[model samples]
Target: MMKEPTIENFLEFEKKYKCNSIKVEGMPIWSLYRYEIHNEIKKQTVGRTAEGSEPPINKKDLLTMALNALKPFNYRNVDVLFVCDGRRSKNADTGVYENIYLDEISKKFNSVILEQPENRKHSTPNGMDNVYFTDRVAFKTNLAVKLSTKFNTPKRKRYEAGVRAAFTDIFKAIKEEFGPDITDKMVDEMVDRMYYYEITKKYCGKILDKAQPKLIVELCYYLINNFAMSELGKERGIPTAEYAHGFAFPTHTPMQFNPEERISVLPDYHLTYSKSQEDEVHFPDNVKLVPVGFPFFERERDRYKAKYPREEKTIVFISALAEGEQISKMAAEVSEALGDEYRVIYKLHPKEFGYYKERFPWLANSKVEVIDNSENHMFRYLAESGTIVCTRTAALQEGIGFGCRVILLNFGDTALNLKTLIEKENIPLVDTAEEITDLIKNNKAAFVNPNGMYEPNAIENLTRFISEIMMN
Candidate 1:
């Protein structure tokens, strides 16, 4: 019933744009975005996988595909570029292939450029003269701030008053607890620790008895832009500029902003590109979105049934517990508490699997299985699961779609608001393991509310938008 574009349509797009060069930019988290576009474009235009391989690709394979895609456009003056956050800090293979891909793409175009952090000291092939390095902090600050204001939610007067009160309390606590002997170094350390603590709690599931002095410092940095600007200037050893020049792509919104120019990417996508650093400015207008795809060997139902055919346990799907170890541990605790009564499976985000592997090595040998394969789709897991437990993941919607029980855990202030939506829409919400166990014990069926939140056809909309941009 859905109208999907064919491979031919994508090939036509490649020809039309003469897409000799494309700059791929964004964090590792955007791998999903990259994979979709790379797969679609390669299949349609090249009539093969871009990496000269089949599905389930790695960094090298993907780079090969990117190089292959640009091979046909060799006659054009334009060059394709691929950019990423400092890959050296992340993956060695990724950083190396990024350079390799840039070199290969350069052979096809007048210039192929790969941008990396100026501070990073990774050696690459010298023949790849197209490789360009730039100040990572400068580029990031410029780009992020430019696009940040656009997504900034205007604070209500009441919220502002609350913030002021919270700040006053924080300052009072800091002065009283740390004493007047607190040096600048002490203050900085305190702030850093608090920031780490709060973030760990929010994303990773660590709770604090009270707000730390460090949190107050971090909050001050966030609220007082001048302070951050001054601190960054000191750290970079550069004169503070009046306005930030770069652009950023915030997660909540795909929009880009330029703080220095006070311009937004909504009106002009051209600004998304960096002018000085060819490697740094890669922003592709086009994108593709693909579902987790059909049944695979890693589907939770298949694996569980195959392993334990006679046992009947309620299945709870914990989607992508990869961001923070604390959060993963909390999910693990919930699972442990539930025990044999329920089977809890933690699905790691494909992009964050590496992080999970490093942070939770014990998971490899634990009773809890971390599903890492791409073939094991999210929807299939949800379809087979009895309940889905998550902290603001998109998987909640999919679980709901499959009529699986939904539990929003440790939402804090957002809890009541979410509860209202669930009540109005007739969806269920559980915040604790005890509550979840009770729901399962009672044999509750999750109600589907027709008026529940709507997820747009982001891929189709994005593809069509990119088509229009290219046409212009």
Candidate 2:
């Protein structure tokens, strides 16, 4: 009998041969890597000494092979109805985008409709299209979640193996294409992203059936779900586009440079933040990059005149993953350094505040008033803040928009791409707590956009871009 193929065996193979995948001429990085792994296993095990035996295939391989096998959905008719999902961020969803931008966009076209998995939805508007991938994905995910509570069973473990393998494929694929410039943390992150991305594709067939939208427009197209949604639209011959919600830094994923033109899954049109961001991603020829301003910036608060300048000293610290201690220590340091003149406000990411709280027990003892907003009101802190500090977060960009003197704590595994943004934006990147104090005391940073970082006509550009794609 052939040796049973396990994730352990595959991982051992990966660690040994992880850096050895050669690029195929026309294929994308992942397709070539998958091909190599599958063939290498077969070449070693299935021939020569043994008379007749086939190499054992793993679950992840099976899924990847099956990805392009299915014929796309064909809905013969068409409506100008635009379909998209709600913002995964609760704050962004309920805040302004849904009520303001989405409503305005919806009104411009024939109608805009929601596409959400039926079982997973809650309090979504009743009139929207209900997609049906929840039955399949929910069963697998719920079981994994339940089994994850204490320990996973052998059966659960096997499926978990598949999950890890999927993530591994994604990580290897990025490295194979982009070379060794990627950080280990980013590779790991993109893997989990690929796993979630695969689950989201399970919705495409359901979405296509319910609403054969002429064009699919999504918020935050960079996210796995929206990206997956747009890819599915392309598969079925529908035009797709995305509105830029934030900066697309850390450009290490396949989304930045899809290897094969045949399987390029990026959205057809990208409504970007500005010209600076447009030059950042370096996407392929087929993907249209449109420069637009940040629409939400018009609503950003510029009103507060300093009435009592001394008392208005508030330092806001945006938290980073596994850096709870750093945040707490920084808060304490800022308070001590400035005495009663400065107050530190730490804003926690969902990871820090959610299930991973145990990893950050120092939050309880910290002097800073930690906040996690449901209203996307991090802007309020930036508006009122005298100085803002972060590891690597979009809030840093928000701080820029508000004219707060920003500082980046570039310690440990803070993303290299963030360093790129800091250099480009001219924000101060500090290493030690002492450096932060000096920068804060000096109040030395540019208050104006040097690169014309924000284009003024965002909504106009986005609307016009969509109109062009639809017309084409």
Candidate 3:
């Protein structure tokens, strides 16, 4: 495992470079460090944090950071400015704040910058405000090409070539708009600088620098961060451990907030459009719970029904099909133990389906069906199923809400808290496939009438929380 870098090292780099001004464009949703920069350091805001907290700094911070990093360079005097889209702000208020902030900051700088690779602008809500926001030094584009090359197949080569062509076109357009002197060599060098500064340092081992998707995302961050830092007149150097910010959840890891770390957390269900109450847990004072909204409730419900036609068999829902192989094998054992009486359905992670499909072809053909469609409502499937089984998936809560026989599979000591939660809530726990079979056979009626364990308001609570966060 890679050792987590120390904050002291990161801060040392920040101080050494004299990176006084920082411009951040992404949402501070999962990333706590962005909040530290904006709220604690009072840097300018490119936009609101994920929880809708306004940053202290405005667009000028980005310009200042960029200028400081690339001192003596005349990018400050450039007539055009390019601003790429980062995380989406909550609402029009946030959008307007971003626009006005950028406009005010641009006036303080010299360039009339344009943002884009053209295609990325499609998702921005306010297109008019993003006329010139493109980063020629895209790490993603390069990474895609590198991945394609590494794979080294006719199909992969074609994909890489397509990416390169698209980037080249965008680069050409930007150069034509600005001037021919923004040579290809200069662009390549800048992109390289960004790669080292933003990506290679953090994701050195987990992702190949030249890999397609990894490269692309890293490049995007590099371009955006590099531009902002350059405007602030800071020098690009090997980012120290202190410069390494807090790890963002979702983007960094699928797990919940570390109880040991002093970090902010939005309500678990609040990040989605569900209106669920924040569950009380021992959290640090520095952390705040922001709400999230779920816009796809109805659509998700409809999709779930459409994809997994409900059947008579008891449904056992499993998340992280890749990581929960033992649970799956156990499920299979339970199915055998029960004979033809039960139905087992495995909900495969959408991204990992291809791998799972390859590994478990039996699941595809067996009475046990593997559902891979994410657009479908997972909760709905759980509702219709007879029982739900998982070691430590969030789906257990959803299953209980649907009045299904929720079974907790104790994989290891890591899931002790989950087991405790289930036991305290009076949720059922099964130790083995034989026990699962016995429970199904003996307590079929009780499983269907689960009492005092369901909380259907999770969606509503989540939605309300998100709205509140955004509005606040």
Pick the lDDT winner: 2
**Residue ranges of candidate 3 with Cα displaced over 4 Å:** 1-284, 291-312, 361-365, 444-472
Model 1 CA deviation exceeding 4 Å by range? 1-261, 264-314, 319-330, 333-341, 349-366, 372-375, 412-420, 426-428, 449-463
Where's the lowest-lDDT run of ten residues in candidate 3? 238-247
lDDT on C-alpha atoms for all candidate structures:
0.36, 0.52, 0.39
| TM-scores vs. true structure, each candidate | 0.38, 0.64, 0.44
Tens-digit lDDT string for candidate 2 (1-472): 3342222343334345433232222112342233233333333443211011223334543343344224243333344434444333333433432332354555566543443332233223322232212233333433334444346456345444543554455545434532322334443333333344455566555656666677777665544446566667776888777766666663323234432244334667776777767655655567777787765554433432232232236888887653566665766676567665567777776445443246555555656667754344566667667777886565666676666766778753344667566666677766667777777777764343423557776667667766776787
TM-score computed on alpha carbons, candidate 3: 0.44
Question: Roughly what TM-score does model 2 have, to 2 decimal places?
Answer: 0.64
Per-residue lDDT for 193-254 in model 3, tens only?
33333442233222111221100111122233423322222122211100001112221122
State which candidate has the highest TM-score.
2
When 1 and 3 are scored with TM-score, the better candidate is 3
